[model samples]
Target: MTAGEDISVRRKKLRYRAWHRGTREMDLVLGPFADAHVESYDHAALDRLEALMSEEDPPLLKWVMGQETPPDNVDLAFLELVIADHHARLAK
Candidate 1:
């Protein structure tokens, strides 16, 4: 994206990517989360999420589903936030 690009455009792009992930499981996991939070996220959070999105779907599914933990080198705080939010929605 152009340096002139700002949050709104970046957010829209994020939402689009989340919804269009090649796997249906990924789309379901990420699309709603992005819709709910991307617009409100700080640049640093967005940067983290964007980096996360570059990862393959299988590992993300494992992490989000709690079948496997995120790696030690990865950031956990934000991932926990997302996983907790996802689980909360499921509980509702």
Candidate 2:
């Protein structure tokens, strides 16, 4: 219904696993929250995520691969939550 919700739905439709073989690739493409678990995301959420991830060091690629955790940033946490929700929905 919302922009975030829309992104999540689209992500679910994508062949995420195929596109991202493991956490390494996921992190590079999706960022730290790549492994967080997204269930219902929308465009706005993704845009926010991109903005947040882009500003991080190691390119968030390392984080998604379990190499590290993002700094304590409110925006990052919020994006992670959205990504996690979308991942959950895709699992179903």
Model 2, 63-86: lDDT tens digits are: 444466666653666646645654
Which prediction has the highest lDDT against the true structure? 1
Candidate 1 clash pair list = none
**Relative to the true structure, how large is the alpha-carbon lDDT of every model?**
0.85, 0.51
Per-model TM-score on C-alpha atoms: 0.86, 0.34
Off by over 4 Å in 2: 1-28, 31-44, 56-59, 74-92
- Give lDDT tens digits, candidate 1, residues 1-92: 66446788999999999999899988987888899999888789899889778878999889999899888866788778778878877888
